[model samples]
Target: MSRLLLLSPLLLFLGLAYLLPLSGVMLQSVTTPEPGLQNYSAALGDPLVWSVIWRTLRVCLCVTVLAVVLAYPLTLLWLKGNTATRVLVELAIMIPFWLSVLSRAFGWLSLLSNRGLINSWLQSLGIIAEPLTMVRNEFGVVIGMMHFLIPFAVFPLASAMRSVDDRVILAARGMGASRMRIFWQIFVPMTKSGIVGAALLVFVFSLGFYIVPTLLGGGRSVMIAELIYLRIFQIPNWGLAAALSALLMVSIGAFLVALIKRAGVSTT
Candidate 1:
């Protein structure tokens, strides 16, 4: 009872800070523009809205995949590296966390733009006749998102790895299990929780991303967040913006539920 009471302040704070605002937005969504669920049907029926949703999902999947591929190796490497090497690698991975999202997005633009460092070097080397269109596209968004998400992916993996019993692995090795065999059969099975957790976390973060995609994607790459922003500020459609926000939440919730169900089945 005391513990429950202790948590009440936080619960109250959350209700006031998060739930209240979200409820207001959701309420406004339905009440505005004639008090019907037409906003949802209208948004979904529109091809452009659907396209934006699809693009958001596609980019999120790509970001999740890339983060997994890059993060797993780095996590393993971190475990295997010497103290000094581990320190440096950890510091490097954490740089993203230290930097603001705006800084990171601008930094990518400066590095990937036509006159950016990469283009300058490539041009000076005569590698390409002209600068590549790397920035202000899907490619740039993916790169920026991957950079933002890899460290987040690594944390869960490292945590799961820490739970692995080294002695059990050593025993398997002593029993003539090859390194490859041990990795696939033992290490991987143990760390799957981390991988799944990281993937889902990264995917969720990618869905809410506003800065990297909008800025790095050169305004052409419109995400759900950016769309919501435009509806609220530029297009100035409060009803549409509220409806879009609700839809975004619903879509994300559905995906999370499906993932949880799938994980439950796999574990069983």
Candidate 2:
């Protein structure tokens, strides 16, 4: 009874903040502009909707893979480095969190745009006659997302790496195992949970990304989130938007369930 009383405020917060809004969205998805599943039926039949969903999945996949690949080395450095090195690496990972997502998206825009610094430098050195189309495309969107997600991947990876017994690594070295052999045979296998956790974390977060994709993709690489925005704000299709929102929420919920299972989290 005491625990329930203690949790009442939090439960009320969740009811108000999440359950109510979600219920409203689901109800609107079916009941708005006349009742039935027509909105979902139309969304499923639309080629453009399918294209956006697939594109969103692809971008999320790219970001997950890149974040894990890049974060592995950084995590290793963080785990094994000296105090000063660890501080610098940690600062690099955490500093970006202080900035708003919109600011980071715009920052990437300045650096990746056709007339941006990178292209200007390349052009000045006569490396290319024209500016490269970096922003307003999938490449730019992937780059921005990769940068944002790598930090998320690193922390989980670091946690996993810390759990590894260093003495086992020493024993492998003592047995004349090469550094590469030990890493592949011992280190990576032991950290498999962390890798999966990081990948799932990054992928799930990537699916709902709006500002970064919208600003960087410039409509050329429109993702599901941006499409939802267009449906609601521009096209004024509330029913369709609500349907897409509900679908996206379901998909993310599935991924989160998988994440919890992978982490061996207790639901009780």
Candidate 3:
């Protein structure tokens, strides 16, 4: 009873600050445009909405795959390396988090632009007659997102890998198991949960990403979050914006549910 009383303020705050606002958004999404399912209908019926949704999913898929692919090797290193080396690698992974997302996006924009570092180096070496279109496309978006998400994927996988006992691997090797076989049959399965968790986190983070995609994606590529910003601020279409936001929330919720289910997270 004492603990319950002590927790009352936190519960009240959550109800007021988080749940209330979320409830309002849901209400507005359903109610603002004539108090019916019109907005949802429009969202479902529109091809552009579907396109944005698909693009967001595609970018997220690519980012998650890239982050995991890069992180697996890094995880092994972190798990097996000496203290100093592990610290250095971990610091490198975390450096981007210290910088603002917008700042990172701009930095990538500078590097990936047609006349930027890579192109300049190529030109100096007489490797190409013209600058490559590296920025303002899907390529730029994926690169920027991968840079941001690799650390997220790495940390979880490294943690999981570190939990694995090296003696177990040694014992497996002693039993005539090859290095590749040991890794595939033992290490990979052990780290499966962590990989799933990292992929889910990276996918969810990438889904609502705005600045990197907006800056690097140009006019051709549009994400749902950016579209929501435009609708609210630029177009002043509150109803549609709220509807889009609700859809985003629903999508995120569904993804989380699917992730938890697939990862076998126990709810009880």
Residue 243 miss distance in model 2 (angstroms): 0.7
- Encode model 2's per-residue lDDT on 118-235: one tens digit a residue: 9999999999999999999999999999999899999889888998998999999999999999999999999998898999999999999999999999999999999999999999
Worst 10 residues of 2 by lDDT: 259-268
lDDT of each: 0.90, 0.94, 0.86
Q: Choose the strongest candidate by lDDT.
A: 2
Whole-model lDDT for model 1 versus the true structure?
A: 0.90
Instruction: State the lDDT of candidate 3 residue by residue for 30-89, as single tens digits.
Output: 887579888888877989888988988888899899999898998777768899988988
Ranking by lDDT: 2, 1, 3
TM-scores, all candidates, are: 0.89, 0.95, 0.89
Q: Which stretches of candidate 2 lie above 4 Å from their native place? A: 1-6, 265-268
Local lDDT at 207 for model 1: 95
Model 1 CA deviation exceeding 4 Å by range: 1-16, 254-268
